[model samples]
Target: MDQLETMTCSRCGGSGHFSYNQIHGTRCYGCNGTGKKYTKRGAAAAKFLSDLRSIPAEQFKVGDLILYQGISHSKFVRITSVEVSRAKDQGCYSGDGEYQQVKIQCEGGYGAYYRPGNLVRKGCGAEMKSEQLRQALAFQATLTKNGTPRKRAT
Candidate 1:
């Protein structure tokens, strides 16, 4: 296998082959029996998927450093308390995203009731590579294999 393009199968120890072979073993589940290796894209997708599922700093526990928006860049603040309550989205797109209110109090004698879905963790945005898996998933659902966006019904 070409290292620059694809990886060698590790699951079957590169023994599995696309064609019949007497000495080598059959392909394993890692690469669908064709090869036991994961493509570069597959590895990248795994990384992005993990980033997508992981909680924001494990739900921002007390004493956790947070970078709040509506504040200066990277001006970290410590979390003092966290609570949840019923609240509407406080933005122009008031009807979108999570509606449950998340109240966070900082140790600096200040508090902010950030709008749900407005609190974006670092590397968690449309333009971020950390969201590449999500972008791929969304695109697969909304686009065709030939690189054309699918059309919706009228």
Candidate 2:
């Protein structure tokens, strides 16, 4: 899991400035009038890290907490199976349905997992390295080299 590089300020908890001199009704310039510096990793970055860990189905199991990509929040889900079901239209923005579909139960809330390719589709400002796909394919080689599990968390 990736740790937040910076934390919210303790004094004002990242309000970015503080209102001081109450009698004069003035703000504090020392703290930038909002009292806290923005964290290096803000809410969006935090959410992105959380989403990375919540990539869903690390290991297929029953009643595991499942998460679908392109959805809002850490929506918990109960899983039934993790095996590939059939080749279905993934509705990918890349217009490529090359990947196989792994069917899952909704278990109440939204249960749609967006294809990773959609990250490029939305112009999300993230680019995968050319070697990333190759490394993913050669997982055993990566594990041998790193000798550490590539753990992701939400």
Candidate 3:
């Protein structure tokens, strides 16, 4: 992959300043208050990576599963709708330099806007299913009464 280009810091919004509380502000940790950040790769290169793991917005369809890049947790969501629009310039780290925006709706009724290159297709259905199964089993284990294990059927 080609080296990533320098982009604005998503955390500080390229301002080099962030609020710590209602009364105080501090330098952004993500960029050391530099107001700029480097992309892991350029937008075009990022598209290639996204394509390997996710379908591009131009090709997205209803009911397709996708991974939202802006969230902290790794969760695959079913896409319910897609919208395309123009984005405003964000200083030095602006997306694609073309300002294109893509909005997506998930099955859980949550929605967010992103650059097309930021959205990736999820490729781990089995992993997600297994995780759900594990959680279910753990919940079942917590339901035992008086510390007694459930008896097995003969």
Candidate 4:
């Protein structure tokens, strides 16, 4: 039986050839110019992609507008996302990442991110009486388009 073999590198034009110079003499190899190797993607890559999609909108503030689309009375939210976070310190490397629920605030009050679509939810905004919410949305949209100044994120 016979087996097949593949080229080690395609960078050198399949010659498998490379050159080097030493204090004593010069040398050449048939494999590589530097004898280094390439590696594949790691677990970090997958985590990064997942994080990108799950952006923490809760970081936004009171006058911010978020992309919201559902059966709710309104198609968008005028208030900012609210996130409750707690710090956890083990010993050496202290870090904070975990989160719970996000809520949107309006002149009337606060509500769950998903409760706006809930039938039993009761609130001025929930009842579709969102004059303030509507104004906030419109103002924020125009401000965003005109590049109006906003508070810097802390």
Clashing pairs in 4: 16-30
lDDT of 2 by residue, 65-110 (tens): 5544453455446665555544555475344656655455556644
Estimate the overall C-alpha local distance difference test score of candidate 2. 0.43
lDDT of model 3, residue 31: 81
What's each prediction's TM-score? Answer: 0.34, 0.35, 0.39, 0.24
Put down candidate 4 lDDT per residue, 56-122, tens digits, no spaces.
5455556654445445554344564454543344353434543233465543344445322222212
Give the Cα error of residue 92 in candidate 2, in Å: 4.2
Task: Between candidates 2 and 3, name the one with more favorable lDDT.
Answer: 3
Q: lDDT of all the models against the reference?
A: 0.55, 0.43, 0.63, 0.38
Candidate 1 deviant stretches above 4 angstroms? 1-58, 88-98, 115-154
Candidate 1, residues 13-59, lDDT tens digits: the string is: 66564454564345455566666454554454444454554444326
Question: Which one is best on TM-score?
Answer: 3
Model 4: lDDT of residue 118: 26
User: What is the alpha-carbon lDDT of model 1 when measured against the actual structure?
Assistant: 0.55
RMSD of each: 16.6, 13.9, 17.6, 22.1
lDDT of 3 at 3: 39
**Candidate 3 residue lDDT tens string, 1-154:** 1233458899989999887754335878788789987454333333443444555565666777777655457667888998888766768454576577788898887667767766456545677645544544443443334233456669
Q: Model 4 misses residue 91 by how many Å?
A: 31
